[model samples]
Target chain A: MAPVTMIEAIREALDEEMQRDPAVVLIGEDIGVYGGAFKATEGLLAKYGWERVIDTPISETAIIGAAVGMSYQGLRPVAEMQFMDFIACCFNQMVNFVAKSHYRWGGPVPMVVRGPCGGGVHGGPFHSQNPEMWFVHTPGLKVVCPSTAYDAKGLLKSAIRDNNPVLCLEHKFLYRRVKEELPAEDYTVPIGKLAVRRTGRDLTIATYGAMTLHTLEAAEELAMEGIEAEVLDLRTLAPLDREGILESVRRTHKLLVVHEDVKTGGVAGEIAATVNEQAFEELDGPVLRVTSLDAPVPFSPPLEEHFLPQVADVTRAARELARY
Target chain B: MELPEMKYPLSREQLLDLYYFMRLTRELDEQLVRLFRQNKVVGGLYSSIGQEATSVGTAYTLEKRDWMAPMIRNVGGLLVKGFRPRDILMQYMARSGSPTGGKDGTSHFGDLQERHVVSPISMLGDLIPVMTGVAMGGRYLGQKLVTMTWIGDGGTSTGAFHEGMNLAAAQRAPFVCVVENNQWAYSTPVARQVPLHDLAERARAYGIASYVVDGNDVVAVYQTTKEAVERARRGEGPALVESKTMRMKGHAQHDAAVYVPPEMFEYWKARDPIARYETWLTERKVWDKKTKAEIERRIERELKEELEFAENSPLPEPEVAERGVYCEGCHTIEARWERPIEQLQPPKASVQAAWTVSDFGGTNGGGAAAKAHAPEAAEETKPAAVAAKAAAVSTRGANGGTKRSARAAARPKRRR
Candidate 1:
């Protein structure tokens, strides 16, 4: 079996789900004939046809609204945002309609709103954004960001089947860059569960999406300095895996939360707050975060690199946390 | 004012059913207003006193298989869609037995199982795309069903409305959008909202058909909507029917509507839908004093029973409020498939593009100024041949009764 890229893994997840369930449909801009902006839905149109692979107009509100409506009719629709940053355009639909549907009416809105997110590929402010915090704050919605190819496919498959609105934020930087030979059989990673990417004892580096790769790289760097940093990929952000975070913190006695999103109001703040609330005694030191500066992602490679948390940032944060 | 003779294919019972539903809608809201006065209604009570025909008439065209989403003032549509008067009263009162189980208030309740009614989101014009998706999903399931939803005059200005309309048109989905141009949107006039006199003209930009009808004229609204529904069912894409009417009362029970001119009220008062509909029924000898009195008496009796039921209904326990946020095995939503799924399989489901170039624009152009009830007014106001073409697609249907004496007392004055 050939090793598949994260993009291929995601496409496989969608292809397999559509073939397995007739109710699974895809709707997004450039997703059908254009094969998606990132080609994540490439070849799906020809195989499943247009009804299942819908090329919607550039209307995020309608894309998500239509997905909600489709879900109401027992169709599990996976609506893609051409760029997840444009999700702000449909914020009202997502928050007010989709998120509140189940709570307000007990209608199971089984739909997946998946798209590429996060800054690292020099996609700039509009294309590169980690907007999961918005949906994370929303109660009824479940948010997930997969860092590896295996988790990308597994988590997406689970999200599609889940009877709630799930936001699958794929890191654009890791889409084709990360590759792994996946199993031949079907599998799904449970939502609201974190993945332990690497095991260590000295400190725990909690991260997700593209930052997971950087965290792992930083862990390798930390290992050279005799500091064993365990990398915990916080895949699901909304229902933050508090137990998993505590268990890792309890094992390592030090926590260093890392993410590509801006530091202010980022997922790291929630993770820090959770640890302080539940596992305050278990922590050997104060919880620290390695996150991007609170500013728009610049287009310049150097500035964007500066704006995003890099491998060095995690290593530096983990080193400081280990010393603390 | 004399109305033009328009042939309608409706039975006497169906015609009376229209009147019954409209009167029921008005009577139910009047009762809700009374409930509001008693501090039973949990939220604001919106009165559809004047726009009953627009909601009831347009919604009446829908078959049981079709889907419809109603806005706040479309309580009449809820009745027409088979929602019990008690279901609505209890919903406003936030009782446990309400359709939403006291989770929501006002017209924010839908019957997905039986009536196929999609609940109205507080954010206006959001349902347009939702119904469009329903239409699309229905097509994928190989079911022949048209989806409809109502939007207000102000709501038409929403980005969702434009985007949803475009999606419907581009996909050639079986979708109908009723723009209830009831003059004002929470104190702002339609003129203040948009420069266009006819909101239907907004549909032309999307390359879909649009129709202008006298919303107060129940028969006209029914006929126009029926035509649009048939067009959508035929895969002619979406159609926007702008039902021109007025919101006779304030935005809700809380609003005094002091911004509206006294003459404006008197003018629309002279053209009250129920009064006009009664006159239409009487002039045609469809119902005499005895029949009208019997219908009114039955409505009163029905309202009393439903109100009692609503009052008797228990409030949801505090613990119950904590439940049902996510599916978590609490509820199961299964779509009723009327058609087989095999048609969506492979060869039959294959399509070259998302959009099909339907004959939607010229000749029998999608735009029409349908003057079904207004005849002998002026040469410029004559019905277009397109309206006749649209009529050839559907059969026929019928609108309201009266203002309650409690309405004036229920309405609160605006605070300075």
Candidate 2:
């Protein structure tokens, strides 16, 4: 079998799940006839017909709110946001209603909000964003960011099957850039497990989403300089893989967190604080992070490049940490 | 307009039931206000004092399969849709037996499965889209269900209101949007919310049918909403019915309503919905003084029993806060990440082995070659080349007489 791109993997997962469960349906703008802004939902409208593949008006509030109503009626709706940046429009529905419905009334909202996210695509502020931390801070939502095609397919399937609200943030940069040969048999990656992309003893690079590629590249660069940098891909953010993070910190004794979101309230800060509190004794150096600047994603290429964390940034951060 | 001597569409027994439910809702509102004054109720009371006709009339038209998304002031609607007096009282008391399991102790209570009622969120106009979605889902499932959602006059100004109305109209969804133009939105008068005289006229922008009725008259409200509901169920599309009424009380128990002019207050007070309904019923010989007194006594007795049940209901246990944040059997909340770091197993062999470049088909350099490469040379030189290449491509697209340039040049300037 040939390796499939992340977009193909996600589409295959949606197709298989919709075939496996009649309750599963697709709802979003341009998802039906247009096949999606990025074509991640290509071929679904042809297979599922109009009822299952709905083309909704440009209303995030209605899309999310309707998904919640559908979930209440025992349907598993997989809603697309075109770009996750527009998800802010439906934050009230997601945080106030979809996330808390089960907690408030014991009505489990089996729904998945999937979209292309991250900063490397030069989609500017409106299209490119890594807003997982916003949902991570919100309770009653599971946030997943898969770097590999296998994890992208498996985690999405699991998210569709789970009886709670899940935000599947697919990196736009890796939609076609990353690829892997997925098994023909059905499989699902558990929600709370972190994948150890690389292992080492000198230092650990903790990251997820598109940053995993940069972190892995940095590790390759660091390995040449006699520094064995381990890379930990935190697939799930809300119910974070605490065991994997602590285990890596214990083995490497140093931590460098990387992400593409702004620095102040990003997941890196959370990881740094966690290591500082739980695994402080094992650390030989201060917990450092390589993240984007504290500003909106700029549309220009140079500004965006500067605003995002690059492979060289991770390599430099890893080199400084390895010495400590 | 003169009070029309219109014929009643319902039977005598149905008219009596409507009267009884309206009276019950008013009594419950009065009780809640009394409880609030006595410091027994947990939150401020939002009463449906003079607006009972709108809720009762609209909710009475709904079938069991149909859904009603009510606002905070729709206690009458909730009562008509199978919510017991005891259930509402228990909810206000914040008891363990409440529908929200004591999580939300205010007016945010509904039984989605039993009565198809969407619990209200605090944000106005949010439920419109939710109810529209419910209607869309029902229509897709081929069910003859119409979703009715209520909003105040001020809520019509919200972006969500426009979105919901536009989507419902565009999709031809089975939805009935009822705007309770009760003259005030939390002390801001109707004139301040919208410049137009009639809120129903706003529905014309969505190309949906619209109607305006005297909301103080229960029969009128029932008739107008019945037509809207029937039209929606027939898949004709959404309709907006603006019920013109007045809020006889302040927005809630906490307000003194001093902002209202005395003349205006007296004007609406004379057209009180419950009293007018009583007069209409009495004129038809369907209701009499004896029946009214008996019904009042029955409601009073029922209220006493429900109040006792609520007051005696035990408070939730301390650990109950830890529960209900997520669904049962779902993943446990990782509270503070308390697992011991030392007990976890070491890195697996598969992950350690996958780190080598050989596993990646060696497209990139192996360990030794990557180490000997100068870091500055590799870091500084590669990205510069890529940036230059990208910049040249973008510049060509911008100025080289291409189709992309025409689109970019023709693009309108965006607002800040």
Candidates' chain B TM-scores in the order shown: 0.84, 0.77
Candidate 1 Cα deviation (angstroms), residue A142: 1.0
Candidate 2 pairs with clashing backbones: A224-B371
lDDT of 2 at B318: 74
Task: For residues B175-219, write the lDDT of model 2, one tens digit per residue.
Answer: 988999888988899898799877877876776666677788788
**Model 2 chain A poorest 10 in a row by lDDT:** A45-54
Deviation from native of the Cα of residue B329 in model 2, angstroms: 3.5
Q: Residues B283-349, candidate 1: write the lDDT tens digits.
A: 8888889999999999999899998998899999989878877889765756566666664556565
Q: lDDT score, residue B44, model 1? A: 85
Each candidate's TM vs. the true structure? Answer: 0.91, 0.86
Residue runs of model 1 more than 4 Å from their true location after superposition: B1-8, B333-342, B347-388, B391-416
- What is the C-alpha RMSD, rounded to one decimal, of candidate 1? 8.1
What lDDT does candidate 1 reach at residue B47? 89
Which candidate's TM-score is highest? Answer: 1
- RMSD, one per candidate, in order: 8.1, 17.4
Candidate 1: DockQ?
0.50
